[model samples]
Target chain A: MTQIYNFSAGPAVLPKEVLQQAAAEMLDWHGSGMSVMEMSHRGAEFMSILETALADLRELLAVPDNYKILFMQGGALAENAIIPMNLVGRKPQPATIDFVHTGSWTAKSINEAKKYANVRIAAAAPDGRFHAVPKRAGWNLHRDAAYLHVCTNETIDGVEYHFNPDAGDVPIVADMSSHILSRVIDVAKYGVIFAGAQKNIGPAGLTIVIVREDLLGHALPCCPSAFDWKIVAEHGSMYNTPPTYAIYIAGLVFQWLKRQGGVAAMEQRNIAKASLLYDYLDASAFYRNEIAKDSRSRMNVPFFLRDESLNEAFLVGAKAHGLLQLKGHKSVGGMRASLYNAMPIEGVQALVDYLKEFEQKYG
Target chain B: MTQIYNFSAGPAVLPKEVLQQAAAEMLDWHGSGMSVMEMSHRGAEFMSILETALADLRELLAVPDNYKILFMQGGALAENAIIPMNLVGRKPQPATIDFVHTGSWTAKSINEAKKYANVRIAAAAPDGRFHAVPKRAGWNLHRDAAYLHVCTNETIDGVEYHFNPDAGDVPIVADMSSHILSRVIDVAKYGVIFAGAQKNIGPAGLTIVIVREDLLGHALPCCPSAFDWKIVAEHGSMYNTPPTYAIYIAGLVFQWLKRQGGVAAMEQRNIAKASLLYDYLDASAFYRNEIAKDSRSRMNVPFFLRDESLNEAFLVGAKAHGLLQLKGHKSVGGMRASLYNAMPIEGVQALVDYLKEFEQKYG
Candidate 1:
């Protein structure tokens, strides 16, 4: 097998150990003579897998007792609409929601929320640069809004919130899609925190939503029952046929995370990896990362070559060097290297070496 | 490795060959040096896999040019609400939806649809006894309904529709969750056919929806953009990050189905398999099936022993004999053998032999 590191933004690289264990258990999971894929979601074997995954995730994130974790499908994009649909009914008909438009994701959250509520852009990073999060104090939140929403980490723009904003009495709903497990958090601060599993958790199909107990039964009449937090919580996320195999794999990833010393250890490694690449990009004239230093994402770092002509050659060479998916999102044309919990420091070192080699040849 | 037969209703048994190929390629799919799980959904590798899957499924069903096959998330339960959210906009506000309440799944669909539309129970099977599909002549369908909804196969009831009822000009939406690939049908007859990929297909999470082209762009304002069929179709089902790994497995299953001679050949096998078990049950004094003979599901056969006390012993001995998941739904206390596309005739024979042995010993 080739020694390779994948840098795709999402549906991205998973740990080799996880993949190996999954492969070993593909035909017959734990001598049960049935693959995880073949087990009924309601069966004893799968229920235990789901329970363990939920528990491990709670332990890793130090989630508060007030929160209920929901394993759902459809990713962060779906959450954009689901959040508003589930929350807006907290107020009267045509309720309002406050949003901090940090980047592409929150901007999207605002647009989707508008379909279900009266959206007030509480704060927005200046210009279309998407390089920084607006200061917490700068937000002009609605006094009695249904919820204040924010995208803590922007996968495309490389911006991330360093501080949790105080929304007073209103609950804050944060979309932590990209950098969810990269740092420690006070789960008590936000009313809800959601992350699509592709980046740091497990797979794309599973969307993890952590909500306070009070936030459960208030979904709007138009909210689909399967997506209604109350129904999902009551069924233990089995209101619908859940992404069972993905949940099983996520449980395995959670166990793997615990084995690697939980979220605290993961954060330290993420900081080290992010710094190594950012320091090199800042020091070099050949490449530049545009996001504000303090607001830059530790999970996804998008940088550009000083000269545009060498871009194709850079990616081609990177692939040959066993580096892959360096191309940035089409919406933001450049390159991005996502260093998730599954990504090791060794992978970062190799990426740095490749950057230097490519610069020496073309700088 | 122990050879086991899985009789689970869903997340059910897959073809042995498919599992073997999947296990062999789990670490590195098709020499790509990346597990299918690790591939980027937008990348060429996964795109090729997705394209082939759609092409193969279309070929297998002989799907028409006007119908688009959408690979979605959230399963059929979610689609119950999603359907009304998308179609009600085509008519006046609070559009009426006519439903046939035959069994558990249809009742669920009707309840979910009520949240989005004015639901009319066009027909009902009495006292929750799912012994038969209500005859079409007895249905009191709303003349101005937005759509007529039916569950082609009731997984819990062990009942199936053997005929398609006309809805005048109103489109028909069929929840074919448990029996989708077990038979061939005319695609043009229905406006939409939706199924969760836990049975006959491949894993859960991935949902298959075949909808006519005209049903595309009528989603109500309350409909989540991610669940909106028009927006989803336009984005190639990538409005949200899809269930990439599940889709890949489904593609594999579709390829496997093709090798076993498409839906037509599989239908013949299913008919024979259903006949074998049903004939034996009818001939025996110890066992009985309650579903109407004409409407009995070819995919799920639920039978009860005359001596209910023997149930535990029967299951315990069956498990020891390598037959698994024969316990019927808790709501219906009996045994069900789900003969999906993956169940070989040999496995059916084995179950039949066990039934005969048990009856002889207990009689």
Candidate 2:
């Protein structure tokens, strides 16, 4: 059987060791004589798992004591509406929300916020091509804005913010779904940080949210109690039966991350891995990556073939050669290879090698 | 291990065969060379899994063609608010939602619904002990109400509705989280039936919503697009990435159910299991189940020892006998043994045997 490297943008590749460990313990987790899925969320076994996961995540992120980490559902897409619903109420009726639209996710946040608040485009990437994050100085932030929303990493558009923007006293809310834990960032920089647990985390259903303590309890009257950050934090994410199995998988991944020397070590490897693919794309006349170098995402690298007609042949050959899901999102036609924390440098090398071989064959 | 029987009300036990199959396929799903968790939701591999799961569920329940099955997140608790938000728009401003408060879950639904629409207590279980499902003849359902809310099975109160209510021209929304697939039901009777996947299904974090076609597009402006029935059904539940891995596990459970002869067969077995324990409780002097005989839950059996002081000793002894999570919810003191579809009759007999031994020693 061919060894496969999966490049799916989300629900992407996971560390093989985590999968192996999960399989080994599927029927009985740590001699509890029950699968983690079967244990009550209130049971001692699952409670321990949740507590340890919470503590481990805090340690890994160096989260401040003033912040609350919540495990939520409905993913970041749901949070597009949930965020404004919870934040805008802190201001006044129909609060204004500032948004710096880098790409797909930011635009989604803007649209959802409009349902709950007034939305002002603080900045938008040039013309909707979304090839780069706009310069910070050009952003039109408002002092009285309820909050500023940003998609730190645009999975589809392949742009990422390397530096945090100063939002003055207003809080910065980030949708870090694609790049969260692939690299290190200051946890205190944002008022709220949410990432869907598919890429660089665990699975699809669970969502990881880190919010400052001050941001709690301001949800609009319409926000679902289960999705209210304050309610979830108060109940320790057990307000609703959490995606238990997903949280367990994420715990295993976090343990694996710790063994690999935490997020900083993973970030160094991610940097090396991203450079391997980007440097090759830069040198190759047959392939081109559109995102600016400064804004290129370490986690998701979307590239296009010089001749559009070769896209199908390129993906077909890549798949046949032990590569998978290399096709880019339909919105941005070409290819995308996501280098999450779980993706080893070898897989990136394999992708780079496949790109070169395909180029040589057609160039 | 003494052959454990897990009785957690939610995040409860699943069929051993299903867990074995999931473990076997944790790393690579049917030669896709990627774990189910690692596949893109839109990719052919994951899409096939989703489709099979959907088809299997629709077949198992004989869901009508006019209904849309949505795979959602946040469990039934989240749906408490989502349901009203999506439903109240079908009526005029300040729509009245009629609710029959049977137990804890029904009370929760009523409270959440009140946030979106006016809630009328069509009926309330006598004295709030929730010993029986209120007689339908006494329910004061308003003809002009937007919808009628009921909890077909209450996990905490251990009350189950033996029959459906007739609401003239009004849709009935049923929360069947605890007993969804434990027995056969008429899916056509309810306009919407939602269940959390922790009990009688697969795992936590996944909520199964079966909604009639006509209920699809009446969401209020505050409704999250991911939670909007119309948007979710139109996208085939991929308006947001449906819980992919949970759906896969559910698909496995559905296939296992078919091998065991579908829901009708499971219903017969469930009847035997429920009767075995209920009969013993009824005959015993030392133990008594409080719920009215007719309203006793086939899935969750909450009972009390004649002497409440023995609760801790009873739970400890049950654990020693490899019967787990026997302690009832704090709101209702005593013990609860959930006989979900995954729980076999042998587990119930063991519980009865333990009850006899304890009675002989303590009576």
> Against the true structure, whose TM-score is highest?
2
Tell me the TM-score of each prediction against the true structure. Answer: 0.98, 0.99
* Best prediction by lDDT: 2
The digit string of per-residue lDDT tens for model 2 on B1-363 reads: 679998889888999999999999999899989999999999999889999999999999999999999999989999999999988899999999999999899878887887899999999976867999999899998999999999999999999999977787899999999988778889999999999998889989899999999988899999988898898888989988888999999999999999999999999998999999999998888888888988999999999998999989898999999999999899988899989989888999998999999889888
Worst 10-residue lDDT window, candidate 1 chain B: B26-35
Which of the numbered candidates is closest to the native, going by highest DockQ? 2
Off by over 4 Å in 1: B126-128
Give candidate 2's iRMS in Å, 1 decimal: 0.7
Query: Cα deviation of B88 in candidate 2 (Å)?
Result: 0.9
List model 2 lDDT by residue over A234-352, tens digit each.
99898989999999999999999999999999999999999999999999999999898999999899999999999889988988998998889888888999988988899999988
Off by over 4 Å in 2: none
Residue-level lDDT of model 1, residues A143-241, one tens digit each, is 889999988899988888888777989999989988888899888999999999988878779999999999989888888888999899999999999
